[model samples]
Target: MRADIVVGLQWGDEGKGKVVDYLASLYNAVVRFNGGPNAGHTVIANNTSFTFHHIPSGALRGTKLFIAPGMLVNPEILNEEILSLKQLVSSFYLKIDSRTSLITPADVVLDKKIEELKGASSIGTTLRGIGPAYSSKALRISPRVVDVLNESFDFSIYKKLYNVEFESELWLKNAKKTLKDYASDVREELLEILSKQGNVLFESAQGTLLDPIYGTYPYVTSSNTTASYAFVSSGIPYKYSGKVIGVLKAYSTRVGKGPMPTEMSEDLAMVIREGGKEYGATTGRARRIGWLDIPALKYATEINGTDEIFITKLDVLSGIKELKVAVSYNIDGKEVENFSPLENIESAKAVYQNLDPIPKLYASDISYIIKNGWRAAPVQMRKYVSFIEESLRTKISYASLGAERGMTVKVE
Candidate 1:
């Protein structure tokens, strides 16, 4: 069995962790390929909620987890996450790639300093040192996990270079002690799994719209948040990568500073936010809500080569009288159905089409809808689903009615 990739199609916080947790039982291992503590993947199972920063969401179910070299490791945060999980799920192992880069205390200090310098124009970073750590990796000056494990390495060099105050010796000692049990070369284990035809799940952080290369510039994250990075990030072959599942919300929401063409009125946004509990799992920042942007969703599906789609939080819109979908973008007075990352996206306006709201749906109702098409679905909801299928030309394989692991309905 090849690896199945799960990614977020919209901005971050697309309920990826919940979907991953639901699907994790089908895979032998869940591998985290990119991003860092900046990502907040929240999962709910057995009425217990978990907000994962560095650990894979599958770990809550005792699935074997691997952190790849493409990811940035913040040892302190990871240690805290691990310790917290141990209180609930007892039997779990986290395998960390030796080549993974470390996010030093200096990097954290530099991150806050950079954000402080930006002031009001800051990109709304989580200030978790992810950007600085990635910058260090790109410059080939970052210390790897293996380097941190070495007895001779001096982490004080970072404190001196960045002019940040950190007890490097003490922090390093603690981190070293914490990570000693998890550090290893995970590539060999992944290879063995593939060789034995065992299924793997490569869980991605953030979303396609936050991807550095494909997302809106200057507002994107430091790492590639697409399924295309699975091979390189996991040190696995392209042949082992199977289906790519792109997870999207019923509507759009963004956390940081960037142009949101379909942004809604504050009162309506607040209602949706409260309905969906739209807050960053990592930062706890309230998200900016908007109507579903079809053009952006289509563009993301095309870029990620999404094989199947998972739509989440459909229940959040149950009580709304009407729903507005962004059918296209009017940029410089020209209407376009296709969307490209823009340099001045703030000037773009969304062309919306309103539809009637669906009656309230339960988790089982959604399961029936998925198993049988939209034959029995509400007329307005049918139109919404049809529009999505036609726009992306992909199958809607899963629908999530709530945040719990069992709240998902499978279409395939």
Candidate 2:
């Protein structure tokens, strides 16, 4: 069977974890293609909330989970996550690629020191050693999962290269004990699964706008967050690649420092932030809120070849007096619609089109909409989705009303 991909269209924290969890039940395996500890995908299932950093959100659905080579594995975080899952899930399949890069304590220290040196120019990173780990991998000095399992692996290489001292012995011992069981030839396994006609879901961590190459450079995450990279990271041939499902929110939100042209007023932002619980799942920092950015959304969809869109957190906009969508960007007095704002992000100003307000929805209204379909939604809510669909020229397959898996409306 072909592999379908789920990716975030905006900046990080686009509620992709919940989307993956909701869709995982239909697939046999879920593969995480990129990012690492810095990614926080929160899923609310069985009335229990799970914040996943390294594991796929499909864990609760008992889907087979694969950590691909494109990821950086932090043993401590993965260990804690496994322990937590054990309490709730009886048994789940998990495998890590032997070629996956390892994140060591030395890398964490290097991350902090580099951030400190950046000072005013710091990228507001999670400081989870993601950048440093990727850097080491590129330099061919990073240890892979298989290296940790090897008896001849040396830990002093970090000290010799970075001039830092850590509890190398303890880290080594714990890493071996934590990862030895899960490490395997994930490429071969994925191939075998595809040969057997098993359906797979590729779950991407960060959003396309934060990709290291295509995103707002220097301010973007360390890994490639685009959907096309999913095949490369998962070691699955492009021939098996299937539909690309792009996930976004009713409005845009970003956690770290970057140019968000459609940012709203501080007072309005605080209202939406609190209503949406807009805080970074990994860093707990308050996210910068903005109106839906159509230009950026269009760019993301085009780059990812998104076949369908899944919108989340539409409930957060209820009760607001008015709603606005950024139809274009004004750069140096020129109104531009096609070019991405990131081309001149610092000077680009968002041009918004105001729409009617969605009346405050009660719990019963949300329940009805969830139980029925989009036709049961408020007229204003339906209009909002229509505007977005027309703007992106993509069909919206799903709309999430709340955090629960059941709080979703399947579009007819």
TM-score of each model, paired residue for residue: 0.95, 0.98
**Local accuracy by lDDT, each model:** 0.86, 0.91
> Compared to the true structure, candidate 2 yields what TM-score?
0.98
> How many pairs collide in each candidate, listed in order?
0, 0
| lDDT tens digits, residue span 257-327, model 1 | 98789999999999999989998888889999999999899989988899999999887988787788998
Each prediction's RMSD to truth: 2.0, 1.0
> Which regions of candidate 1 deviate over 4 angstroms?
361-377
lDDT, model 2: 0.91
Weakest lDDT window of 10 consecutive positions for candidate 1: 369-378
Indicate which candidate wins on lDDT.
Answer: 2
Off by over 4 Å in 2: none
